[model samples]
Target: MDNKAVEALTEAEAKAELAQLAGALAQANILYHGQDAPGISDSEYDALKQRNALIEARFPKLKRPDSPSEQVGAAPSEGFAKVTHVVRMLSLSNAFDGDDIIEFDERIRRYLGLGDVAPLEYTAEPKIDGLSLSLRYEAGKLIHAATRGDGAVGENVTTNARTIAERVAEGRKLPDIPLLIDGAPDVLEVRGEVYMSHADFADLNTRQVARSDKQFANPRNAAAGSLRQLDSAVTRRRPLRFFAYAWGELSAPLSDTQMGAIERLNDFGFQINPLTALCDGPAGMLAHYDKIEQLRAALGYDIDGVVYKVNDLSLQGRLGFRSTTPRWAIAHKFPAELAWTHLEAIEIQVGRTGALSPVARLQPVTVGGVVVSNATLHNQDYITGLDSKGQEIRGGKDIREGDWVQVYRAGDVIPKVANVDLSKRPEGSAVYVFPDKCPECGSPAIREDGDAVHRCTGGLICPAQAVEKLKHFVGRAAFDIEGLGAKQVEQFYLDGWVKEPSDIFTLGERFSSGLQQLKNREGWGEKSANKLFQAIEEKRNIPFARVLFSLGIRHVGEQASNLITRNYTSWPALITAMDAAAACEGVEWDNLLGIDGVGDVMARSLVMAFAPGPERDSIDKLTGHLNIEDAEHPDIDGSPVAGKIVVFTGTLEKMTRAEAKARAEALGAKVSGSVSAKTDLLVAGPGAGSKAKKAADLGIETIDEDGWLQLIDGL
Candidate 1:
C-alpha cells in the first residue's frame, strides 16, 4: 500500500497498512541482519518503519504485537552457536534531518520533565556501517565475543574476534583487545563495530576473485562474513578492525557520563573513534553530524550516519528503553547520495502477499563507493509520475524504459530511483506499464481499494506466494533447517516435492519410498540427501513460537507468536483459546485482548486463522508431523514481584510512567495499564483515580510511590 500521511489515514486504514508494514519490515530485517544483504534501500526501510510508528501514534490501539516499531534486528543466523547476551544489544531509532535531531532532543528533555531551555549534554560519533560485535572480559581477562544477533541472543565468534587486534595499520601497532588488564572490573562487555577499511576490502575482493571465490557486494558484508568465519585463520587474513563505542554487561560503572566511559575504554587498550566528541545540545549534535558527513569519504571505512547519546549516565538510566530501541539515543543518517544511471528495464516481482513490486534494472554505476545496478520503482503510481495520493512527482514527468534516471542511496545499502532525466530519454521509448497479472502464476492482479500496489488474487495457487511462504517456513527465524535456504525452497517447490509446510516433513518418507529418488537428482548425493532429511527431522520437535511464526499468518510475527505462546503456553491451549475467542465476545476474547500487546485486530486475525477453515486444516496437518514444545517463561526467581500483575496509576513524581513500567518489568513484575481482578499490587501516586479505587475495591495490596520503591529496596 502507498504511504499516506498518518493524519490522512482513518483508524481502519491505519490498521490495515500497519499489518503490511509489519510484514515488510520483518522481511527486511531478515535480509539485512540474518543474511547480511538488504533488499530495500535504507531510506525506503526507514520510511516504512517511520510510517508504521506514525500510524501507531495516531491510532495507538491499532499497533500490532509484532509492530516494527518494537522490533530490533532479525534473529541470529543458525550457522554458529548462539550466545545469550547478559544485557541486550538494543538498536537505535533513526533521524533523517536536523529537524528530527532537534525534535529528538526536545523529546528527551520532555521525557525527563525538563524545561524548554534545559541544558542537556549529548555525545555524537560516527555510526560505523559494519557488523556489531560485543567482547566480554571477566576477572581482567578476555573471555568471549559475540555478534549482535537479535539483541538478546548472538552468534559466538570468540576465536575469530581474537584476530582483529593482531593487525598493524598506518605504520602504528593497532591496540589489541587485551587478553588481560590490570585494575579492570571483575566483568566487562565492550560493544563495537567490526569493520574493513576501503583499501582492505578492495584487496580482499581482488584476492577472492584470484582464488575463484565470489566477490563481496560491499565492505560491510565483507567484514561481517570474515568475522563470522568458522575458521579463525580466515578471519586473521581479512584485516578486520574494531572501534569500541558502547558497552553491554558491566560489573561496575565506567564513568558518570557517555564520553567519560569512552575515554575509560580507550584507557584500557581499545580503539575509540577519534572524531567522537561531546555536543552541547541539538545544534551541536547537528553540527557534529554535518562534520561527520563531510569527513565520511576520508574515513577509509563505511559510515552511514552519526549517533547521538544523552551524555549523563544518570539521565540515561532514567530514560531507560523502549521495546527495541533506547529513548536516550538516535542515529541521524546522512542525506542520500545521488548519481545518474541508465534505466535499463523495469521488472515486476511478486511478493508472498501477492504485491507486485517494481524494480529498476540499471547499467552499473558507483554511488557512494558501491555499485548500483538496481533501484526500487515503488509502485505503478511512482513510475507514472504520481505518488500514492495521485500528486505529481518529478514535475509530472513519467519514467520511460530508456530514460536516464537519478538514483540515491540514503544509507549506502540499497539505491532507489529519485528523479528522471527527461531530456536524456531515448526516442520511441515507451512509458512502462505495471503488470495486470502475477508474473509467476498468471493470476489476475488487482489493486485494492486503499492500497497503492497491485496484488494477485491467486492465493495459495500463486507460485510466487506459495514458494515465498515455504521459504519463510524454513527461514532462519522459523524452522531453520540446515542446508535448506531460499534457493533450495524454490527448487523443491518447482520440483513438486514440497507444496506446503506439511510437505517438507514427508520429504524423507516419500523420497525413501521411491516417490522421488533424491540421490539421483542433479545436485544431490546420498550423503547430502540424508543430511537434508536429518535437518528437517531435527526441526520436527520445535518451540511453539517458531511453529506459530512459521505459519506465515497475517499480522503474526516472531514477537506476536512469542506473546501468544507465552500467554497460552501450549499448542492445544492456544488453539482452544483462539477457538473460544473466534466468536469475538466473551471472557476468552477479553483475555486474548488482555495479553498486553495483542489488540482487537491481531486477536481477530489469530481467531480467523485458528477457526474451522483451510488455514486451520493446513496447520493441523503440519502439526501432526511434529512435537511442539510449550512456551518457555523468563527466569524471575529472585525478584519479590515475580509473577505478580502490578498496576501503576496516576501521575508518578519520581519517574515517568514509561520509566516506572520499565523498572517494574526489570524487577520481574508484569506492569498493567489498568487494574483488574488479577492484579496483585497497585502503586498509586498523587491524583489516582478509578483504577486506584478499583484496586481498593478488589482488595489488592495498595502502596504509595515511596512504599512501592521501599518494597523493592536493595533487591
Candidate 2:
C-alpha cells in the first residue's frame, strides 16, 4: 500500500484492510511455521505487517482482536506432540538502521534508570536466518527438543535430536555442537538456531534433484524442513548444525552477563558463534553490525541481521519485555539487495480460479547470490503502477518490457521487481496493455468490484482454466495420481481424452475398449500408461471432502470443503441439501449457512454452484462414475466437542479467533464463522454483538473460553 492510500483510508476501510492482513498473515504463518514452506516472500510479508501496525496506530479502536501483532508463529501441527514452554519463546522486534539501534540502547538505559553517558555494555551476535530450536537437558543428558512454534508452545522433536546424537556417537563427526554436554546444569535448556551451511545446502539440493524431490527455496527453509522430519533417520542424514546463543528454563545462572554466559556455554562444549562479541555501547554495536554485514557472504550460512542485547542479566530483567518481544534486545536487519536487469517480456498465466496473473521475464541477473529470471506482477494494478485500492504508485508510471527494472530478493526468497528506471527507456517504447480477452480461449476477461484480479468468464471452455482445474484434481492434496501430473493432464485435455473431472475415471475404460490408445503417444509407454490407468482406478473410491475441493469452486478451499463434507457426511446428503437450498430459503439453507466457518458469501457461492447449470451437471456426472465415501468424524473418545457445530463470537481473551477455531476443529468440532440454529455451542467472549444475541434467542448453549477449557477438561 502507498502512503497516500494509507493516509486516505477511512475507519471502516482500515478495519477491512486489517482483517485482510490478519487472514493473510495467519495463512503465511501456517505455511511457514507449521508446514516449513513459505508462500510469500519475506519482504511482502513484512510490508503487510508494517502496514497493519501503521493502520492500527491510526485507528486503535478499530483493530480486531485477532490482529497479527498479538500472535506469534502459527499453532503447532498435529504431526508432533505439543510442548508448552517453561519460559515463553519470544520473537524479537526489528530495527532497520543505526538510529533504531541507538534508540534501543537509549530505551534500555532509560528502563534501568541509568544516565545516557554511562557505559551500557551489550553482546552483538549475528541473527541467524534459520530455525529456532530449544534443547532441554536433565542431569546433563539431552531430554527434550522442540521448534519455536508460536512462542507459548512448540513441536516436540526429541526423537529426531536423539537420532542425530546417536549418529554422532558412531564415530561420525557432525558440525561442532556438543550433543551431550558433560558440565551442563541439572536442568538446562540450550536455545539456539539450526542452520544449513552453503556447502551443505548445495549438496542437499543436488540430492533433491537426483531424487526428484522438491528443492528448498533457501538454506533457512532447508534447515527447517530437514529438522522437522517425523522420521528421525531422515533428520540424522541431513547436514544440520546448531549454534547455542541463549538459554531457557535453567536450573542455575551461567554467568552475570550475556557475553559471559555465551563464553561459559562454549566452555561447556556448545558451539558458540565466533562473531559474537562484547560491545561497549551503540558505536561498538553498529560497528560490529557493519563488520558482520561485510563478513556475511563469506560466513557460509545465512545471517539476515545482527542482534544487540544488554550484557547484564539484571539490567535485562529490569528492562523486561513487551507483549511479544524484549525491550532489552533488537535485531538490526540488513537492507534488501536490489540489482537492475532488463525486462524481456510479460506473460499472463491462468490460475485454477480463472484469475490471470502476470509474470515478468527478466534477463538473468544475480541478486543476493541467486539467479533471477522471473518475478510476479501480483495483478494488473501493479503493472499499471496502481495499488490494490487504485491509488497512484510510483507517480502512476507503468513498467514496460526493455526497461531497466530493479529486482530484489528479500530474505533470499522470491525475487520481485522493486522499481523501473525510466531514464534508460528504449526508443518508441509504449505503455504495455494487459490483455482484455483470455489468452487461451478468447473469452472476455472481467474484473469484479472490490477484487484486484481479472478472471476469464469462460469457465469450462477455456483450456487453461480447465487444465489447471484438472491438475488441481490430481494435486497432492486431492486425488494425487502418481503418474498423472500437470504435463499428463494437459496432454489428456489436448487429446480430448479428459475434459472434466469425471473423464479421468473413464480413461482406463476407454483405452480398454480400444477407443483411445494412450501407449502410442510420445512420452507414454506401455508400463507408464498402465501405471496411470491403475492410479486413476485407485482414486475411484474417494472421500467427499477431497472431491468437493477437486471441483475448483471459488472461496471453497480445503478447510471449507472439509467442513462442508463433515456437516453433510455423504454425497447424497450434500446433494439433497444443495438442491433444497437452491429452490428456496428454508431450514436446509439456514443449516448450510450455519456451518461455523460458512459465511453468507461462501454459502451463496456454494448454493449457486450446486444450482441447475453446468457446475451441477458436471458434479452429477462426476459422482456417477465413483463411490463417494462419507466424511468420517475424528476419533476423539469422550470429547465433549466431538461432532458438534461451534460458533465463536466476540473478542476471545485467552486465544485468537483463529486459534479457537483451529483448536475446536482439532477436537472434532465444526467451527462456523457465524452462529445459527444448527450450532450446538456459542463461544461468546467480551464485546460479542448480534451473533451472541442471536444464539441466545435461538436457545443455543453459550460459553466463554474459560468454560470451553472446563468442558474440554471434563472430557
Candidate 3:
C-alpha cells in the first residue's frame, strides 16, 4: 500500500549491503529455480528482498534502474555476430513433493517406452547461485560473455567479458576464477553459473562492516550483483568464479568422455565445477540429487539445487531442442521456492496486433528472491477461469481479486500465477471480464473463431492500433525504414506527421525543410538524417513478400507472405487473383493453395486486409513513399524443399537448421507440413517424434535430417 523505503546509507555502506544482498538472493534463487533445490526458506529470502527494495526506494538517487530491484539481470553480450541459442532453456513440469518427482519419472518412462529400463541416471550437483553466462570458445579461447537476458538475444557485454578474460588470463589477483578461453579457440558458446563462495561473500561483507560499510545479505547475490557491473574491472575485482553446466557453439571436438569433457574444459582454463560427475542412469542421478538435497544446509557456496545431464554426447545431439530448450536435458530441480500473495487487481494490455492480453497486479510478494508485482493473465478465457470449470479444471478453482495466490519462477525466468486461496477472497468481486470495445478507440472488439486471442476491430482509428501499425510499417521486419524506430514513430504521430502505414511515405514531403532540423537533436546529425532518407529510398521499391507482410495482414507472417508472393509471382497478379476468386469457394483457394502452407485461412486474411476497407486509404498513402513492388516468384518446379512438409528435429552434425532450411528452399521441392499424410517424407533424426509416428500412420517415409540433406545434395 505504501512505498517501503529505508533511511539513506553512505556510498560504502550501500555497496556493502548491496553486495551482500546480491550474493544471498542469488544463492537462494539459484537453488530454487535452477537446481530445484531449496537452501534458505522462502520467507527468509522475502525478508531480504523487502530490505533491499526499502533501501533502494529510500535512496532513489543511489538506486540504479539497472539495479537488481528493477532489472532482469544483464543481457548477454553480442560482439561477435550473434548466435541464437539453438536450444531454448525450458523447465520441466514440476512436482512440489516427492510424489511429483516419482510421477515425472513415470512420465519419462511412458513417453520413451522404457518399461523397467535401468533407473534414470541424473548428475546431481549443487545448483550454483549466480548470473548465468554463456561463453563461446573457438578452439578453446573465451570469445564472448553474455547475461541470460530473455533466453534469446542478450546485451553484448564483450567489454566486461574482455576484462574478466584479462584478469583470469593474467592470474594476478583472483587465481580461482573459472577460465574457458585458454588460448582462444574457435566459436564454442558454453553456459554456466558464476558464483562467489558463501565464506567469501561473508568475508567481503565483514570487511565492509569493519569499515562501517553495508553488508551483503548472501553469497548468491554477491556473485550476480558483482558480475553485472558495467565496468569489467569492477567485475574483475569481485571474487567471481564460474562453474560451467552446458554448451552452445563448439569448434574442434570436445573430449570423448563426459567427465573427460569437463576435465578438458578445465584444462582449457575453464573452471568446471568441482562437483559435476558421470552417473550411470536415472538411479545414479536421483541418488546424487538425494545426497545433494540431504546436504541442503551446508555447502561451500550457495547452491539452490543440482543439475543432471546425460553423459553421452551423441545421445545429446540426437535429443536436440524444443521451441526454447533442449530435449537431451532437463534441470531435475528440487522443490522450488514458493510464496503466497493477494491478487490486488487485473488490467488488460493491448498488444501491437490489437490482441487484448490480461495482466494481473498482485500484492507484491517475493518468490524465490525477486519481488514480483505483476503476472501475465494469459488470455480472456484464462482470466474468466473458464477452463477451471470445464475439462481442464483444477478442482474447480477460480481467481478473484484479493484472493491469496501462490507464485514461483521456473528455470529462473517466467514468473507464473500458481494456485489461489479462494477462502481469502474479498466481497463484491466478480469474474474479470474482457472488454468488448477497444480501450483506445472504443471500437467493438472481436474474437476470431480459430484463435484464443480477442482482438480490437478498430483498425485505423484506435490509437494503440495506429501507433503500433506505424511502428510496424517502418520496423526491421517490415519496411526497415532507418531512423524511424518506435520513438520516432511516436514523435511523428504526436506531431501529426504520421498515423497509418501510408503516412510514413508522406513524412519526406510533409517536413522536408524541418527534416533537416532533426539532425541537431540528441542522436541526430546530417550524416544520420541523410542515411535515414537514403534507407527510406532503398526500401521504396518493395519486395512483394515484404510488402505483403508489411500490410499487417492478420495471420500472414514473413514466411507465409513469402509463400503467397511466390505463388502469385507479383503483387498485381496476386491482387487480381484474389479479386477474381473473392467469392470463390474452397475450389478457388485450392488453385493458389498448392503453394506450400497456403490455405483458406491465409487466403481470407489477404483478401480481408487488401479488400477495400476504411484502412484502404492508408494503403494508398503508403504508395507515395513505398517503392513499386519488384518481386516475382522464382520458378518452383526445380526447388527441393517444395512439397515436403519438412519438420526439423534433433541435432544435425552439419550446419544449423536455419542454413539447412534456406538451402532446401533454394531447390524446388515444396516443403510440406509438420509430417502428415500429405508429407512425402518425415526427417527422422535421432529424436524423431509423434510427428514421425503420424507420418508412418499415413504411410509417409521417414528420413533423418541428414538424409533429407543428402536427397537434395548437389541439386
Candidate 4:
C-alpha cells in the first residue's frame, strides 16, 4: 500500500511494472487515437493508471519525466491560435492479440505484491472514431479549445472552440471527475473527441458536390476540415459534436472512481459512452469485452476497439506512466468486418431525394459485422457498360446478382459490392431497368432538366421526406432543440407528439411530465430536463435566414442565405416577395438579373417552395412560435477587404496575418480571386507572389498590405 512495499520490489517486479506501463500506454494510444478502439473500459484503465501513479509517487527516485503518468499527448498546432494545456494529456498502450493480453496479465501479476490469487479488473467500452480535442472552461463559458497535437502544446482554436460549446459547460456536461486541483471560477481542460454525424457528412458531401468542391473521405476528415476553417462562422455551420473521456487541468477533484468521474462528466454535459460498466476483476473485464464484441454491430458509429483503464486515481498513481503511455489502459480491437459473396446483380435505384443510387444484390453474405446480402451501388453510371453510341450498352449488365462478387467495406463501412467476375454470370441475365416510379410513395419519378438524377415529386407527404424534414428542422443548424435529437425526433413524429417544427416548441407544454420521466433515466434528472428546456428556449428565437436554409430548399446555401437576407429585410417581406414572385407566370428576369449568382434553376426552386401549401403553413406557424432576428443591413462597412479580393501574400506589421485578413474582409473591398485588368488595386505585401506579378503584368497597381490598410482607413 506504500513506499515500503515498492522499496522491497524484486528486480523482476520493477521491470514488470515498467514494461506493463509501456505496452499498455502505447496500445491505448493506438486504439484511442490511431484506430478508435480501447482494449479496456475507461474505468478499468483509470484504475491501472492510478495504480502506476501511486507506485511512482512512493518511489520518486525511480520516476521518469517521460512517464505516461506525467506527459500529455503533444504540443499545440501552428495554424490556429495556441492554448497551453494546463493538465498534460497522457497516452495509453494497446494489444492486438490474445498473446499480448496474456503478457499484460502476466506483468500485472508481477507488479502487484499478490501472485496468481490477486486478480486485476478491466472495464471495456467502444473507442469512437474522432479527433482528440481539449476544452478549457473558465466558469461556465468555453474559453479555449486545443488538439492533442503530440500530447502537449496545441494550436488555439477558440473560434472553433465556440462551436463545441455544449461539450465543456458544467451546466451542460459535468467536468471530468477524480481530478485533483485547486481554486474557484475553476479552469478545467476536458479531453474528448469531435465527430461528424453520418447523415451530416452525407449532406456536406452533397453540398460540396453541388459547389464543385472536393469531398472528404470520411467523417473524421470532415470533422477536421470543419474544425480548421479560418472562419468561425464556417465551423458553426458544421455538425460537430463532442464526447468527453479524459482530463487535463482541473481546479477540483471530480469523483472518487473512474466511473464516478465519467458520471460527473455526463452531469456536466460531456457525452460519456453509455456502454461503460464495472467488471469485478480481470476475468470480469475479459467477459465484458466479449459482451461488447456481441453488440458491435448495433453501436451506431464506427469504433476500432475497446479501451480499459484502472478505476481508482489513488491506485492509478501507484501504477505510473511509461515514457509514452500509462500502464493502466489497453485497447481491444474488433476484427475487421468483411465478407465475400456472389454479386447477384447491380441495379440502380432512384431515391426519394433525386439521388440516383446503385445497389448490388449478393449471395447473402455475412458482411455487416453480421449478414448482409445487399449493398448500395451509389450511382447509375457505376453499373452498366457505357456505349460508344453515347448511351448505356444493353445486354451487358456488367454485374449480375448470381455472379461471383467481391464484398468489402467501402471506407470500412456501408458494405459495398466492390467488383464482379464476368465469367461467372448466369446465362442470359438481362440488364437492369431504371425504375420510373417511386418505390415508397408511388409517385412518377422524373429526372431534372440537365441532370442525370431522377427525383420524385412526393413532397412532404412522403414517409422518407417526413422523417428527414423533421430531422433537419431540429438539427444543430436549425432550432437545435436540445432534447430533440434525430432519434427522438423520429420517435416523436411516429408517436404524433410532433408533426412539424412548431410541434417541437409545443412538446414541453404537451407533455412536460413525460419529459420529467426522462429525468429519472440513468443519466438524466430534474436539473437535466430543466436545462434542456432552457436550451430549447434559448434557441426558440430563429434567424429568418437560418430558417429559410433549414427548410431544405434545393440549391440554397449559406451564401444564398446571406443574399436572401440582404434582399428581404424581414421575414414577412421575404415571404411576401416569394409569394408574389411565385405568382408571376415566368422568371422575374429583370429582378433576377440583378443578383450576381442567381441562376434559372435556383430561381425556379425558390418559386416552387414559395408557391405554397404545407411548407407555407409551417413557415407561418413557426413565426408565431419564435422571435426572428431584427432586420438590419449586414455590418460590413469599414473592414479593409469589404469590397476587394485583397489577398495578403506576406506578413503584416500592423497585425497578425489573421487579424489583417479579418480586417480586410471587414472593409468594403470585394476580396477577389486572381487580379486582372478589372482589378481596382492590388494589396501586395513582401511575400506577394503570382497575384502581384499578374497585377503588374496587367497594369494593375500594387500596394503593400500596410498601404492597403491606410487606403481602407481613408474609406
Best candidate (score: lDDT): 1
> Against the unseen true structure, what C-alpha lDDT does each candidate score?
0.81, 0.78, 0.58, 0.59
How would you encode candidate 4's per-residue C-alpha lDDT over 92-120 as one tens digit per residue?
Answer: 66555465566666665454433676645
Tell me each candidate's TM-score.
Answer: 0.88, 0.66, 0.64, 0.45
Which residue pairs collide in model 2, if any? Answer: 596-671, 596-672, 596-673, 597-672, 597-673
The candidates, ranked best first by TM-score, are: 1, 2, 3, 4
> How well is each residue in 488-541 modelled by candidate 3, as lDDT tens digits?
888878777677776666556777765577777777888887777676667778
**What lDDT does model 4 reach?**
0.59
Ranking by lDDT: 1, 2, 4, 3
Q: Between 1 and 4, whose TM-score is larger? A: 1
Tens digits of per-residue lDDT for model 2, 1-715: 3456677776656655665565556556766777776533455556666677779767755554346766677656556788989998887777777877887787676555678898789899999988888988888878889988888789899887665555442223443455667778898988999888898899998999999988877787888888889888888878887788999998989999999999988887777889999999999999999899999989988988898899999877656665467778888877766788999999988766678778889888765544567766767778899865667777887889888898765432235577888898899997889888999899999976666667899988999988988987875446767677767788888888899989888876665742337667776777877777887888988888889888867656666787789899998999899999999959888888667556566677788889999988998898898888999988788778888888888887765565566567668787777777778999888988999999989999999889987888644
lDDT-best of 1 and 4: 1
Across 287-399, the per-residue lDDT of candidate 1 in tens digits comes to 88888888988989988889999999999988888878999999887655678989888888887767787878999887655566777676788789975456688898888
Superposed by TM-score, candidate 1 places the C-alpha of residue 695 at a distance from the truth, in angstroms, of 5.9
Looking at model 1, residue 240 earns an lDDT score of 86
The segments of candidate 3 whose C-alpha lies over 4 angstroms from its true place after superposition are 1-132, 137-154, 166-189, 194-239, 296-308, 334-336, 379-385, 388-434, 446-454, 469-488, 513-588, 591-607, 610-670, 674-715
